[model samples]
Target: MDISIVLNLHDEAEYVSKTLESLEQAMVYAVKRGVQIELIVVIDNEKDDIGTIVEQFNFSVPSKIIKVKNCSLGPSRNDGISLARGEFVAVADGDDLVSANYFYDSFVFIKKLEKNKDRVIVFPEYVMHFDRFCFITKFVDSDQFSAEDFAYFNPYP
Candidate 1:
């Protein structure tokens, strides 16, 4: 597999369906571009209906569901990442929705960096925040920031 998306969830039953739909669209776009993709869903809350929502959704790529009692996002993400079989792995939240071109565009960018691809990390150029606050922010490329910049703030989220 070329990419494995690890989606971590904790009591996000209300939003899992939309998230899955967005992911499926992105997966289809990536597959059409000849990028192999897989999805790994980690459910940290067994009391919720997130698992049922995931099971009912149709995915275009190979997908796996992992139920865990970790209760913490960090460990839940770790569990999903551990099962990833792709050359590249992406971490996603159950309540987040990504653009349909996210995966395809990312793979195109990675292919351009023929030599240092392994050392690079790709982040969305624009992040749209909603619900509590509504705004969109454009992130600076890695080369645009210095090491000292990280000491003050994080450029990647």
Candidate 2:
């Protein structure tokens, strides 16, 4: 497979559907380009009704639901990654909405970088949505920092 999308969900039943829909939109683009993808949702709440809703979505790729109880984000994500069968794994939060081009664009980019052994590419823009508004933040000329840079540079600052 080309990519495996791991979505970590808690009790955000109301928002999971929207997130899934956004993914479906991205999947449309990916399908056109013939990029293989899978959806892995690691949910902590079995009774949250999100599973029932997820079952309704006819995802082109295979999907898996891992049910756990009171799991932390790190462990849940780790579990999802462990189960991933794709060459690349993309992580998404259950309540967040992704752009329509996210999967397709990333798949293309990954194909180019697949020649290299290890690398991390960060996108320049991200949209932050609040209760009343949303803002798009773009990082111009962002450079890839190394482990040594992390020791000296305060990224948040």
Candidate 3:
């Protein structure tokens, strides 16, 4: 399968190296299971480090790093899309790791989701872990909601 991986990064210099290393392992696993990845890394312009990170590793691997000044998820995702040459794009943060099964399974599931023209997005159900507990929950598409809709919205910030 041919796929594009869009990684959104910002002022995460501390964790980005570990994150990228993990991503490299994940990509290796994906390729072994028949996936060709086009990695599009979109980084916020301020205090950039993605370039250094990509260079620190062996660039013999396939990937592209893009820098956008002060860009957020929406713009970075758009920027990634502009650079993507694959048929489908998978989303990830600069700090998240995908399970080994993610590539093989999501490839099957996302294909079916694409068939439903009415559904612009298909999200996976995730299990949340809090201090000593875990619970399964539905995923949220943040773009579909207003501040008034999310009852559990936190205001601590």
Which number leads on lDDT?
Answer: 1
RMSD of each: 1.7, 3.0, 5.2
Query: Which parts of model 1 are misplaced by more than 4 Å?
Result: 116-118
Clashing residue pairs in candidate 2 are none
Q: Global CA lDDT of candidate 1, please?
A: 0.87
Candidate 2, TM-score vs. the true structure?
A: 0.81
TM-scores of all models?
0.90, 0.81, 0.70
Candidate 3 TM-score, true structure as reference: 0.70
lDDT of candidate 1 over 1-157, digit per residue (tens): 9999999988878888889999989999999889999999998866677788888888879999989998788988999999999988988997789999998898778878856636678888788876687888898877788999889999775
Candidate 2 weakest lDDT stretch, 10 residues: 136-145
lDDT of 2 by residue, 1-157 (tens): 8888998988778888888989888877887889888889888755578878877778877889888775688988998999999988988887888788888888777677866854766452655654566565544433565557668875432
RMSD of 3: 5.2
Model 2: residue 2 alpha-carbon error in angstroms: 0.6
User: Which has the higher TM-score value, candidate number 1 or candidate number 2?
Assistant: 1
